[model samples]
Target: MRIETALAAVAVFSLGLSSADAETPFKLGTFERNGRTFPGLVLEDRWVVDIAAANARLQKQHPSWKALAIPAGMKELIERYDGGLRERLHAIANEPGAATPRVDTYEVKALRVRPPVPDPETMVNAAVNYVEHGAEVAGGTQAPTPSPTMAPSVPGLWERPANDIRWTPYLFLKARSALIGAGEAIRIPPGRDKIDWECELAVIVGRRASRVSVGQAREHIFGYTLEDDVSDRGGRGDARHGSDWLVGKSHDTFAPVGPFIVPKEFVPDPQALAIRFALSGKVMQDSSTARMTHTVDELLQYASNILTLRPGDVISTGSPAGVGFTRNPPVFMKPGDVAACTIERIGTLTNPVAAGP
Candidate 1:
């Protein structure tokens, strides 16, 4: 499809106001019950409105009105999301309490919170997409040394000016099975000692996209969520290749995502959000999405050109500087460390570290 036509299609599907004026009316997630998962509306910090049950109630009154299909899951909801579904959800959410049906209400503490898109078809992550992060990964500059008989030399540093660098995003794939939800334990595997944390802003794709342009990228996005891209630095490389991201990145519980997915309308400017993470009570990685070398749209555009992006596929834009491995004393997460990744507008995803079996 023509880029403009594709963009217009996205606008029609977007349930709320355009990103510029979109307020986060509500958030979406999944909660477990009796070994089954149900899509839910995050009404508040500790409460959720079960969309599946609410839709069933609505179906009884209006048999033909099936905005939220029965047995709805977050993945299915994203695929069928539109203005009508948004309105129906808003109506149910705005009803007066006590008078409203209490059967659909659930406390956050009483159930298991699953990943926003628990079964994403694929999970793509950007590596070193922040300028400072790239430089730090490459090893920062060394101070100029003084010479006994000659002038001191200038320090050597890596530099990539805007005009000199290509706008293309460098992307990599992470295992879909690596996903773990909020409050779950990120088990540190046996024999791997250097486990690090990379707090990132994750983009959830709402539609199927292939060869999409940057202008239409935002429309394809379902919403945003927080992801802690945990890495096993010790398993990063071996003799055959200098770097093996699959080994370093795709371990079980390496990708801790969610808390919930906030729709794009709520996030006016993805680039302006403050992204940070704290280990235990100590702030470790702290930065802003504004520092990213490639914007969300640019990354999506680049990825679409290479492969088709399906609904529920996640694209983690990238992490900022302050990763533990790059520090002077190189810090890493240990068993019992609680890592919490927080992004502005979105929410925090906290997971504890445990030794793997």
Candidate 2:
């Protein structure tokens, strides 16, 4: 069968798809081998196929294929994929004999995986984007208050439209320098005793967008990945600017991102994915993206209204109701503990906890 024929067969995609049946069925990421790093396509969730090398081989054998030049990095790939570059990727994944002996392939278990997008220009994180989470942060018992008496408590973000339309997503900028790849360590900065974890679905931008409408926001999205927005709840140890986020969210190794990026096409309904995080083998945060008080498109539209979102920027859509700082006695991450964030379609991002000076 022709490559195009096979490609069309798998082209039909939908809301929820296992990696096996979806188009491409693979994700894009960066892997380290022989002490060097390069961008590659992770296939069947086990093998890493070197895009540049594999494409060159496919070209030598199939001269009729109109494949564009392999992108030098993940960011470049995102920028060019929609413009006549995705077909070549489809051929690599769907064509039966696409993997030639000459094509470079490595067992994922044998190599080191790095952050797919090492340096996004910016990262905007949402606060209380989930109602149940808002309840937890506000000192509730993880459920909404059915009856309010004195001060008019949070009605669990007050119900959507009633909330989503009246309220804009609360966002904070996190320094890109805080990013750590999968399998790395989430270090506790010196002098901070209360460290917390925020597991979120990170939306990756594919285009340069400024003032875009909510309807057009989806067009600028590239894919989805996971990020652990590690936090330092001990404040700056003072009372000045009690609302300062930099002191709590911008420490190095605080944002643990990646494993890989599943293209938006594969994830038809980002809101349908299951999001959960565990610490030291215990499940802590568990909820679905459907609980998000504001949808991804609405968040993008609001953010683009303030600043241009360029290719490779990330938006952490917010966490659910199980953060450590708001617990009964409060549970915090300590040295030697491990944290793992897993999204259904996107892979898991695991990192160990450490104390740093």
Candidate 3:
């Protein structure tokens, strides 16, 4: 009798716990505007939509489409989530006396749906971290760039922008300003020559870390996202004093990150993903993460040694073989072309290239 009673109590407790867990309100719903359906945040109907929906409506309303200016509040939301911000936004939506910007009146629809955490900082990209890219760029065999002294200080030391000779694990900073949500248009800067696309797996930092060990490095990661390190490959591959990677790589819409942030809990083994890229709907770059010369853990351990990586910092663990510049005939992006970058678990990030400033 006693044993039976204990088992019953255990079952009851488990049931109660599951019931309680279900109460955690997570925003989930489809965002629909002007008769079109797209994934969107689920805020209380009162939340503002001007920034998210305004431009979409305008683009639909007008023929001359302009990129929607990122809203001011978007930054605040990203900052909050960067600090482990997760909660039911509904209470803020439902409370009679909650913050203003009510549901129905807001410009964007606030249907309930989970949104990604804003990255705390921009992506710290390890350039030519792959052996193949290094070899191709050198126009010779894959001779490794002498690994910089494995210390904690080397990551921040490489602060140059894109499109330069990356003899080492040349690190560069992609402006947080350069980030674009998935499915958005990637504006091709005007008067640009040699626009090339690189498919890379970007690691998202999960926790505060400094000098983390390689074994513990994966724990500091939240998950991963996809980014196209679109660069002006023309001047960059020159093997000269300064290839203009910075201006080429940092163009307004050069970096397209998203589809969604695959929370780390879902991806147990990130190093083994398959990454592929398609241009104008044709497969151009195809390879696996296994080809990476520097593993994700090595990259993280090396980066943390240099700077304090706060939650939401991203490291784009280099691209695989088959970048456009590496092609026999050299395939470059042109206007009216859609480039698709796919990595296992992270989903596909597709953007239509448009001519713009």
Candidate 4:
């Protein structure tokens, strides 16, 4: 019963206009069951409350409250989240009894999980945002770094952002067609042998932002989710251009994202989180965001400078060192493989690998 109470407490935290009490923290995602797809509010990492159905019930119970239209999909929900909808969601989560699966709630394990945000306005991804990752994936096959030796008080390459102008984050646009959800199959294109994986921490933009500074970036952040920046090492299998950013990275099923979204309120420090990836239960890329050459704020600031960031837009902060193509023997993801990308405080995004038709 104590464990159950603790779970209820998470969704029941109060949000104040003055000096606030602890804010309620919850995850948002798109899930499917039977035949319909709906947005879900995940509580305590175990339960999923069907947003549309629960809100309807809440409104019926309290006629005094203004009725809000149910969102048709996840993207619509995110766009309307900050505007009156979030408070209604809070009401649904903070219902009288313990927060258990009720009429409109179900165990998350039972649902067919879809990408947290089905359609983002845009996906701006950073390239080589981690220093050591830059070194290892620079060119041909690489051997692992010799040791964790830092000249300072530590013995590692973990350091703060470089002061040079080179630290300005380089951003790329990813096609919306590439996105797939948790537990979905990552179809390896036929004839393209070298399939790689890059586990990254993706930032979900909250509001429409443009020209925002690093200091103001946090406010624009809606939440954080996991993105597997799956790559095709054999670029187009031809030297059409020096590099084929679109073809190499934009293949269908290349971007496996989300199980759900962890609101920024819960993630106090995005850079301090431990991000890792594993294949078929074997650890592959294990690193911390602490090693990022450019922090989330910087990337947000830079990306917003060039283009406006809309609600539900994803900015994949880039992956860490241990990529498959960087190994001496050059490991690659093949059929019958399962890749999982995990972030601290957030859940994992696992996708099964399969061959294309």
Each model's TM-score?
A: 0.84, 0.87, 0.65, 0.84
Instruction: Put down candidate 1 lDDT per residue, 102-214, tens digits, no spaces.
Output: 79888878779999888999899998888778878878753122244432221221123433333345799999889999999999998898999999999999999897777
| C-alpha local distance difference test of each model | 0.79, 0.81, 0.60, 0.81
Candidate 4 lDDT over 128-220, as tens digits, reads 888779878766343233233423221121223333334345689988999999988999888988999999999999888998867899888
lDDT of 3 by residue, 141-237 (tens): 6745544433323354433234333343556777766676655677866676678888999877767779887789887876677878878765645
Off by over 4 Å in 4: 1-24, 63-66, 96-99, 139-165, 238-240
Estimate the overall C-alpha local distance difference test score of candidate 1. Answer: 0.79
For candidate 3, the lDDT comes to: 0.60
Candidate 4 has its poorest 10 consecutive residues by lDDT at 150-159
The TM-score leader among the candidates is 2
Ranked candidates (TM-score, high to low): 2, 4, 1, 3
Assess the local accuracy of residue 324 in candidate 1 as a C-alpha lDDT between 0 and 100.
92
RMSD of 1: 7.7
